[model samples]
Target: MTLIPKSHPRAKSLLIREKLVSGFDNGLVAKEGLLAQGRGEAFDYLLGEKTNQAAKRAIKAAAAQLLQAQKPVISVNGNVAALCPKEIIRLSKQIKAKLEVNLFYTNEKRKQAIIKTLKKNGVKEILGTNSANSTKLPGIDSARRIVDKDGIFAADVVVVPLEDGDRTMALRNAGKTVITFDLNPLSRTSQTANITIVDNVTRAIELLISESKKLTKRNEKSLEKIISDFDNKKNLTENVIQIKNNLTRRARVA
Candidate 1:
């Protein structure tokens, strides 16, 4: 990893890039994962590189939904393992949800690398690896369709961070509630998910953990109310408006 000066305006972004580069070198991230990160960064820029109010509402709703779930599973991919492995573990522990490594660019070596990273970060019994237990998700042809029976397959609610569109829609069709962290409000993953936190996963993951802890004290009725009140379509529309407002504001300043 390169040593970036704190005084640099792009220090945090640069550091995130370095992490992905290192992850690619270390076999924790696929080459395509780097490209996906760059794409998400562009959306992040449009949102002023910060968590917006719409995302906060989504996160709160996501936490409530997870809390109310019969069995919640958090899906980890290569980029997610590379970016926020520790936070993912923290969120899983906080919400009592299971962790499953489900990769799009799936290979045994990369799968083991991600599992090893999670294990090192205090995750035990990570799923979505055993072929005998893996079941195909309907409506997707990617290797990602393979899901663990005890993990994503059996989960009532699945938290898929940095997810692809087809699988998000497939999960919903399979009668599972899908919660996702996607930066682009217009992306299919955002539009299809039951609750979408339209913020960078690296930033919103910690907030999810914190919110999960805070909401744990509330009764099931209150948690249900939080989930019931949230409208995913309306939240995503607000996020799109936020990006447009930011662009319009910048246009005026220029």
Candidate 2:
């Protein structure tokens, strides 16, 4: 027996359209995100759905940073809520980070629905009743909410999963350390995040939980060192070089 139904015409299409529009509005995706979802459905695939070594390291760094912060917040969007709500809640608990529901849609009913889902899964203390603050980052042209009505503005670190580049940039400009998960290495969110995990939100979150547990057993200095060592520019440069080398190797083999 099939564990999950093959398809639902209305449900599937509505889901697809929501993701496509959200991605477009957020700026990390173009029309292509929709196309990819269509293809992914054939094989049970999802966008930003894979994790790797780089992602693990980034998660570790992110965990360390959040744990070290006086105040840290985990910013959640709709896709993140659907994809890894449990993991998100787990990480927030591990690091004592506040959970904030921030979305591009900016609808109270939708936000409450997402919070209800999170609460059902045991997430506590959800914040960001207000919409996200608008930033000057490219592509994101509107305001979005920050979870900690008081703390988000003062947080030293903010973990944002599946985020848009503009908000990521804006958060960084505000002097808060930004951590994010993005599948595409070339996206602005990846480049702007202090620690960008190039992996699926689910896997990356799992690794972050593991890393937080490990770090919690260590001294604070060690944890600080780990966060300090994460250099976004260097990491991006390294990823580019690796990709080019891989392409060159493939050409040679061909």
Candidate 3:
């Protein structure tokens, strides 16, 4: 006799649960990934689902990069849409970045449904490319050619949330600034991003919007300084070391 049956009302969430379990089983998500997600969830809860200092800095740099762009593009995937739909639309408007829907799940009907959902939430322009989108950027294993009608290819900056490693590396190789939101600091996406926020999308986007609003027009130099000082590898290394030290200290105390 089980206290909680498999067919309980909570079973409805099984869809997302199964996806997470599968990701873990397949090595797409690791133990560290789960820990990161837990931290992000806590941050999200504490900030009222808003952003924080580190997240704000990352977002400001991202907005500045896009504002300085000749043609900015916001790469949208399913996770981004599900996590931060309204914020995505808001960020696009603030930076004038075009929305390009790129997903690993290559279902036409589902893609259309996502687009429709975004439009309903006030996203005016959403571009979906064919399954053959390819880039010269090394390590980018995109299933479709990323269509950049706004000349995203020519832009100096791209904001890619929950991005694939291959695309991030390729974008960097193309001489474009890539700002990304990733939970796992060790992941390829984090390693390749110019400014990688080790925070969840919900918190990251809100913080970015707030920072962008407070920024004046003549802060390009300051923004550039922020970008220049951001060391992705260093930050990630520091985070890992700190967590390990804390764990060790706790063990000794125990």
Candidate 4:
């Protein structure tokens, strides 16, 4: 990792880039993952690189949904494994959700590398690595369709950070509630998710863990109410409006 001064304006972004570079070098992140991160970063810049009110609302809903779910699973890919393995492990443990490794660019070596990263961060068990128990998700042709029978296959709710649109739709078709972290509100993954946190995953994930902890004390009815009140389409519209407002503010300054 490069030594980035905290005083640097782009220190956090620089650090994230370094992590991905390290991940790729270590065989944990695919080359495509680097490109995806850049795309998300562009949207993050548009949103001012902070967690907004709409994202907070979606986070709260996601936490509630996770708590209420009988079987919740956090789907991990190379980018998620590289960027926030520790946080992902913590959130999975916090909600008692199973952790599953699913990738669009599937390969045995990269899967093992991701599993290794998670294990280093104190993950006990990970699914979706074994082909024997793997099952295909309907409505998607991507490699992400392969899911563990006991993990994503049986899960009622799934947390997919930095997900693709096709799998998001497929999961919904499979009768699962999908919670996703996406910076671009207009993206297919964002629009298709049941609860879309239109914010940077690195930032929103910690908040999701915290919110999950708080929501655990609430009764089942309370948790259900939170999920019911949330409207994903409306939430996405709010995020788009936020971006427009941000652009307008920036134009005024110019």
Q: After superposition, how far is residue 142 of candidate 1 from its true place, in Å?
A: 0.8
Superposition error at 218 for model 2 (Å): 1.5
- How would you encode candidate 4's per-residue C-alpha lDDT over 1-254 as one tens digit per residue? 88999999999999999999999999999999999999999999999999999999999999999998899999999999889999999999999999999999989999999999999889878998778999989888988988999999999999999999999999999999999999999999998889999999999999999999999899999998999999999999999999999999999999
What is candidate 2's lDDT per residue for 1-254, written digit by digit as tens? 11333476445445545654554454423344455445434322222234545566777888788778888888876666655677888888889988877765566666776787789899757777644542233334555633444556657888877677778887888788888876666778888888987665555678889988998887889988897787767765655555566667767999
Q: Judged by lDDT relative to the true structure, which candidate is superior, 2 or 4?
A: 4
Clashing residue pairs for model 2? 131-144, 131-145, 132-144, 132-145, 133-144, 133-145, 134-143
Overall local distance difference test of candidate 3:
0.64
- Writing each residue's lDDT as its tens digit, candidate 3 over 159-214 gives 88877677787788878888888756677888888888766676568777766666
Q: Report the candidate with higher TM-score, 1 versus 2.
A: 1
Q: In terms of lDDT, which candidate is strongest?
A: 4
* lDDT by residue (tens digit), candidate 1, 100-121: 9898898999999999999999
